[model samples]
Each structure stands twice: as structure tokens, then as C-alpha cells.
Target: MEFNFADRMSDLKGSAIREIFKVIAQPDIISFAGGVPSPDTYPVDALNEISQRLLVGNAAAYLNYGVTNGYPPLIEILKERLTKQGVVKDSDEMMITTGGQQGIDLAAKSILNKGDGLVCENPSFIGALNSFRTYEAELFGVTLQNDGLDVDEFKKTIKENKNIKIAYIIPTFQNPGGVTTSLEKRKKILEICKANGIIIIEDNPYGELRFKGEDVPTIKSLDTDGDTVIYVGSLSKVLSPGMRIGFVVANSKIIGKMEILKQVNDVHTNQFAQALAYEWLKNYDFEEHLEKARLLYKHKCELMLKTMDETFPEFVTYTRPEGGLFILCTINKEGIDSAEVVKACIDKKVAFVPGFTFMVDMTKTSNMFRLNYSTMSDEKIVEGIKILAGVLKTL
Candidate 1:
């Protein structure tokens, strides 16, 4: 027998980053592709202790079906934590998700209708883009500037398309692009979106990973009235990605609806994972843990930057991110495409993601690629860049 799938399934594309992971699974490959947290940074001992306590002391809570909103104590902790990050107020409501990725999916499902217009950074997070696509939302890409989304282009896009339902952004240490939106641009974006009555979906998975830069206030922080922003936060980077704990901060009204949608999605995120994460948070020094992660990534980023400066062709330009896991490399050679470079890197047992996947238009000329420096060792980082540079020489 043959099976049929929904028409919306055709609108989605498989993640380019996931596809690159399959190519780099070979032991010999040096992967600078996935934005994965380093296993070295996970607080394994703390997690182990937490797990033992939970199993020995509170086994029934983990075994039973849980509330759709999440574990209550976990939700309270998230409210306080997000308040410190400037994503929400003490009064603002929050919901724990399976991961930050699920928060994005739930927001798209709860708020968007078919053909609704959504504006995203030109090179945005592919995961969020895929989530929006699954709901049949028409996506529009706005050019990204060093400071933030191009304000002029953003204004123009809003004017051109009045049907825009949401403007999604990864303002701090953006994925793939590795660029942070400036405070001035953040305020300007807030003004524009507020004026247009557009909701801003702020996905900040890498905010606490800063090593060298001054802290920039999140856009959600600038929202005095709480009418226009939906914020997402993740423990994946700072705590444990394996546990897959993340949360969404929004007005209570919106969060109430999203909680219902999340119930249908997976009942709720794993209760045991929620309890474990809370225990870890309660017992561990989160600031010190974050600092260790920052130092490690900073060293790796410096290695990649130094290698690129010495080895890549003069035409190649890349962003020097102050923090975060990735750097964006654009090979400006007229005939060399990013896809071709990625293929060449794969052939040499080195991997990076081609930039076309991050854009709304696939046919556009893309000489860009993304390199992640968070997961590999210093030796692997240096070796991968050297191998990729050798590939560039041939191009």
C-alpha cells in the first residue's frame, strides 16, 4: 500500500546542517559544521548526582504524566532567570519547552496562518525558517548589516508588505552569521515593529556565551509594555543540550495558547529532564560554567581567525564575531560558489555548511559558508581551517 502525506510537507526542506552532519560522521572528518556545544563543558557530575537524587527520592513525579505548562518550580526558576536576561518581567508568563527549537515551532503554529508574511534576517537560523515554512507562511528576507537588520530595508519591507505577522530575529550572537545586532538598531527595530503592530520573535540561544564583548540589552528588554515581543531561551549552550530544556517568555495570554499547542506537540517536555536541569541549576555555579564555555570558544575562534587571515585567498571575507559558536566566510572569487567549496571540503574530510540554505531564495548567488568553532579541539580547529584553506587555493 502507498501512503500520502500532507500538502504542507512539500513546503518544508530538510535541514542543511543536519545533512552536513551525515557527511562528517566518519571518524576521520574534522567538522566545523554543526553549532553543537562542546561535551567538555557539560556538568556531567552534577547531572549524575541530580539524576540519582531524583530516582531515589522522587521517582513517582518523573514516572507520571505532567502538566502541559511544565514543572511549576522549573517555570518559576525560568521566570527569575529570564528576568535577569531582560527577556521578561517578574509578572510575565513563561513555558518550558522540549528545547528552544520546539518553542519556535509552537510560536509558528499558534500565531501564524497560511500566507501570513514573516520577515527574517537575510541569513537567518534555518531551523526557525523551516518551522515557519511548515505553516505555509510566506517568508521575506531583509539584508543584515554589521549593526543589525538593515533598518532602511526593514522599513521598506514593512511598507511594501503590510501583511507581516511577525519579525523573527536571533539578535545576540546570531547563528550561522555570528553577528550581533547593535543597541541602536535594536531600539530602531523595536520602534518600527511597535509602530506596525508586528510581533518580534527573539530567539537568543547564545546570549550568555560572550567572552570579549560588552553586554547588549535584548530587544525584549526594551519592551516596556510587553505587547510586541516573544522571547526564547535555551539551557543547551550554558547547561546541557542533551537534556533539551528551553523556555518561552511572552505575555500570559499568548503563552496560554502556546501551552495548549505544546500539549498536542509532545504532551510536555520530559519531566525528568526538567527536574534534572532544575537540580543542576540549583547546585551548580551557572556563571562559572558559562565563563568556561566562553573561554573555550574564544580560543577556538581565535585559532580559526588566525588561520583564515594567513591561509585563505584575498577575496574571502568573514565576520569576526565577539562571541558565539560560528563565523561567516564569504569567498568573493567570481566563479567559486559556496556549495562547491563545501563539496571540496567534504572530499578532503573537512566539513562546513553552505550559506544558501540560510537564505529565502535558493537561486541567489551565494559565496558564503558558516564555520563553527565550539565543538572541536584546538588541533582539530587549526587542521580543519588549513585543509579548507588548501581547498580555497584550488578554487
Candidate 2:
């Protein structure tokens, strides 16, 4: 049988990182491909206890259908937290979604029309790029510096592309690049977007995972009227990705639209997870857990960076992120093929994602790659880096 798919589906392909995940499932393969949180840090004991107590008494409430906006108690808890961070003034400004990824999709659904231009960092998150592509939006790429997106280039692109409707950014500890946007750069970008009347989708799943640097204020916090920025945050990194709980904070108008769009999507995020998250926040010592997780990641990141500095070829250069799960590395030699390096590494039971996979234009080749140090063991981190260094030497 011949199956017909939508035009957007014609160009949509499975994630290259996820494809790498398949190859690295063998126990021998040490993977740096996935942006997965460490299992060691998960509050399993607490979660198990909560689940049992809830199941014993409140099973029906959790098992039944829930409001599209979210579980009410969860919404209140999250709003309180965000308000403390200066992200939202009230609960009306936010709505829960399936995950940070789903928040990205609903933001695109609510605002982007076909052929609308979406500005993104050149090596942006693959998930967000795919979300925009599904809506048939035109993606324009801007270069990302150590601090953040090139503000001048972003302004130029917005001017050149009058149809550009939204700016998707991961300002703090950005995925794939793992570089935080400076406060000054964030202010400039916000000013430019506000002047251009463009919406800013601030996807910040890793904002709370900082280990080495002072917290930067969120763009959502800087929006004076709560209209210009749609903040997407996740419990996945800090808690559990399996819970599928995330949220969007924006103007009430945007939240209403997203809530409607969300109704047509998954109806609601998981009630059980929402309740669990609420309980965890309300009753548990979350800050202490976060600190412990940060310490683990800092150690792993330092080990990986140290190993790479001592072992990698001098021609290879990489970012030193203050925090977050990934580090972007580039081969200094021009025209160095990333596919050859990836293949060589995989042959030695190591895996990482090539940078081009995260770009708007997958057809373009890059000498860059992204590595994740959060999920691997200290031993595996050392072993994988040494193996990857050996592979690059062969190149």
C-alpha cells in the first residue's frame, strides 16, 4: 500500500542523535550522544514513596482525565517557583505541557503560519528545529558566539527577513553549544525583538542545572509586559524526563492560545507526574537535591574537559561551558569531515552527535560535534575521550 504523507512530513526525518542512540545501545558502546540526565542522581526513593502513598489513597484522581491547562496544585506550585525567579507574576500566565519539547511545538502552533520565518541559532536544538519545520515555517540561521547569538547578525537577519515571526533561543547553557548568553547580550536581543515585534521563545530546560556560574536572569523576567517572551521550562533535567512534565509562561493571551492548542495535542500532561512534582516541590528538599546533581555533573564535566585537554589533538578546540550537559567541539583544520571522525569513534565503541545534525540545514557539513558528559561514568568519560582522541588522530 502506498501511504501519502503531508508535505512537511516529506522533509522530516528521524533525529540523527536518536539514530546514534540505536547504535550505542550495545553495552560496549560508550555514548555521548543523548542529552539524558544521570540515573544516579534521580530521587528514586522519594518518587517511589510518593507513588505508593498516592496510589494507595488518590489513585482515582490521578488516573482520571485532567484539565488541559494542567493539574491545579501543580500549576500553583510551579507559578510560586517561577515568581520567585521573577519569571511570572501569576498562575494565569502559564500552562503545563508534556515536556519542554512539547512547549516548543505548541509555541510554533500558536504563532507560526506557513512560510513564516523563524530565526534560530545555527547549531540549535534538533527538537526545536524539527518542531518549526513541522509547521512549514522557514528557518533562518544566526551564528552563536561564546556568549550567545550574534546580536548584530540577528538584527540584520530580522531586517532582511520581514516575515520572521519568532526568535527561538536557549539563552542559558544552550543545547548542542552549551554556552550561556551574557546578560548584556540577552538585553540587546530582547530589545531588538521587541522593536521588531517578534516573539521570543526561550527554551530553557537546563537553566536550573548550573554548577559553575552565577544565575543569569531569564529573558521572560526581562519582558516588562509579559507579551514578548514565551518561556518553556522542564522538570526533566532537574527531576525526571520520564515524567513528561514541562510548562510555558507567557502573557495570558498566549497561554490561552497554547492551552487550546495543547488540548488538541495530548489533552494534558500526565496527572500522576504532575502530582508527584508538586509533592516533591512542596514537601521535599529540592534545592539540596539540585546541589548534589550539580556536583556530580561538575565532576564529570571537569574530568571530560581535563582528559580532552591532555589527550585531544592540538588542532581540536571545544567550548568550556559554565554549566549544562553538552560541550561543542570544532576541528580547527578546515574541511575536516565530521562523518569520518564519528565513524572512526563508533568503530571503537564510542558515540557522539555531529554538529550539522542540530542545524536548520542538515545538508550542510560541519567540522564540529557535540558531547554530553552528564550520563557517563567517570571511568567511561575518561575511556571514551581517549578512544575519541585516538579516532581523531586517525583523521
Candidate 3:
């Protein structure tokens, strides 16, 4: 029997990396396919203590359904943090989203209509790509350079295209591409988008994990106008992804609409998780936890880069990220299919996502693949790369 679905659901499918989890469930897969943080970094002990206390002291609030805007205490705490970052202002309002991903989806839903124009990096975050697609937004992909999104092409695209409503970008340690947009480019992109009246959705889940290079201010921080950018951030990297603690800072008008959409969507984010996240942030040494995670990831990234340099063929050039979970490798030689390459690695008990999974058009060839360094052990990372390099050599 055939089942008909809505137009928005017509082309949508499960996430590729998520599907990889099912296949790599075996203990020996040495998987590098997920954009996940290392389990070692979770403050499990502190969370366990917090959970017990919350259940004992405020069990009613923890179990009861809360408002669509999220738990008030958590929202206030997150607002304070964003304020210090200089991204949120009195004119701006915020909401605590289920995760950074939800913030991206909600922001897109608030402003985009069917057939509206959308812009993104050529190889952007797969999750954001799929979210924008759900709105049936016509997406324009700008090629990403080593430093960031191609600014010149961005200006050209905006000038040529009409009805382009939003520009979604992961400026720092970008997913799949592992590139950070430079400071100058950030200002220029903001100027161009503001001039053209395009909303900028800045997804920043990995900002606090920077292990190298100088920190680049977010586009929202640079936007003194305060109406041009929607800054989305998540504590998943530093704290826990399971809690789904994420926040969005946008103009009060946009946030008000998004809050209503949130009311209809899930009614609210999980109240218990919000309480847990709030207690932890207010009482714990979050900065200490963050510093430790940063150091661990820094070591892991350096190790992965070193091993790739030694094992992979020179033709397979990859990004050396300042900080992030991924390093995207592009096969310089022609006629190579990345899908086939991924399969070969799987056969060797090593797995990674094909680069096409993150593209605006998956049918188009990029000859690139992504490797992760944050979830696996030092030994496994070394072994996986050695095995993967062997497969690439035979190509």
C-alpha cells in the first residue's frame, strides 16, 4: 500500500548520520560519522546530584507542563549570558528552544513563506539544510573558502536574487566544512544582508569550544542595528545535549511570532530539562567544565589532523579546523564518487558521512567526506584513520 504525505514531507527523510548510528552499533566499528560531543566531557556527577535535588524539592514543577517560552529561570539565565556576549539588547527577546536545531527550524518557520528565497553555505550543516527545505524555501548555496563563506559571491547572489528572505550560516567551526567566517567577512555579510533586507540566522552550537586561533565576534554582536540577525546558541557542546538547552535572540517582533509557533508546535520545551539546566548553570563551575572540554577536544583535533596528514594520500586535502568535531576532506582527483568511498570505509569497520548529505543538492558531487574527532577515543581515532587511508589509497 502507498501512503500519501504532505508536500513538505514529500522529499524529507531521516538524517544520514543518524542512520549511520544504526549500522555502526557494533562495538568495533570505530565510527567517526556523528557530530556528537565526547561522553567523557559530560558532567554526569553534577547532573546526577542536581536531578536528585530537583525531584526531591520541586517535583511538581519538574513534572508539570510549562509555558511555550520555556522555564522562566532558564530563560533569564540564558538571556544574561547572551547579554554579556553583547548580542542581545533591550529591543531583542529570546526563547529557550528544545535544542539549537529547533531554534533554526523555528526562526525559518517564522519568516519564510512557500517559494521564498533562502541562502546558505555550499556545504553547511545538514540539519539546517533540511530545516530550511521543509519551508520550501528556494536555497542558494555560496561556496565556502578557507576563512569562511564567499562574501563576493554572496553580494552577487543577493543582488541577482529577489525575495531572498534569510541567510543561514554556521560562522564558527562550521559543520561539514570546518571553516570559520573571518571578522571582516562577518561585517560585510551583515552590511549586505541588512541592505538587502535579508534576515541572518546564525547557528552557533560550537562557539565556546574554540581550541585555537582568536575568537571572532558573532554577526549579531556586530549588528548595532539589532534587527538584522537571529543568534541561536546551544549548551550541548559544553553541558549536555540530552537536556536540549538552547536559546535564540532576535527582535521582539520575530521572537513573539516564534513563541506562538512554539506554543502550537510542542506547547513548550521539556520543563524538567529546563530546571536541570537552570540549576546547573547557576550553581556549577560551568567555566571550568568548558575549559576542560576545550582542552580535550583541542588534543583530539590535533591528533586527528596529524594522523590524516601522515596516513591519507596527499591528494585528499582536508581542513585544519581551529575547533569543531569535523574535518572535511575533498578528494582532489576526478571521477571519484564519495558515496562509494564511504561504503569502502564501512567495509573496513570505519564509517563517515558522505559530503553530499550536507549539500543543497545531494545529487551534485562534491567529492568530499566528513570525519569527526570529538566522540571517539584516541586509539580508535588513530586506527580508524589508518584504515580509512588504506581505502582511499586504493582509489
TM-score of each predicted structure versus truth = 0.97, 0.98, 0.98
| C-alpha lDDT of residue 361 in model 1 | 76
lDDT (tens digit, per residue) of candidate 1 on 107-184: 888889999999989999998999998899999999877777898999899999988989999998898889999999
lDDT of each: 0.88, 0.91, 0.90
Q: What is the C-alpha RMSD of each candidate to the true structure, in Å?
A: 1.2, 1.1, 1.0
Total clashes in model 2, counting residue pairs 3 or more apart in sequence or in different chains:
0
lDDT (10s digit) by residue, model 3, range 159-207: 8999799999899999988889999999999999998989999999998
Better of 1 and 3 by TM-score: 3
Worst 10 residues of 1 by lDDT: 83-92
Residues 1-395 of candidate 2 have per-residue lDDT tens digits of 99887899988989998899899889998999889789998898999989998999879999999999999999899888899999986534789889999999998999999999999888999999999999999999999999999989999999999999999999999999999999999999999999999999999999998999799999989886647899999999999999989999988988899988888898899898999998888889989999998999999999999999999999999999888899999998878878678988898899999988988889878899999999999999999999999888766
TM-score of 1: 0.97
lDDT of 1 at 330: 86
Off by over 4 Å in 3: none
Using lDDT as the measure, name the better of candidate 1 and candidate 2. 2
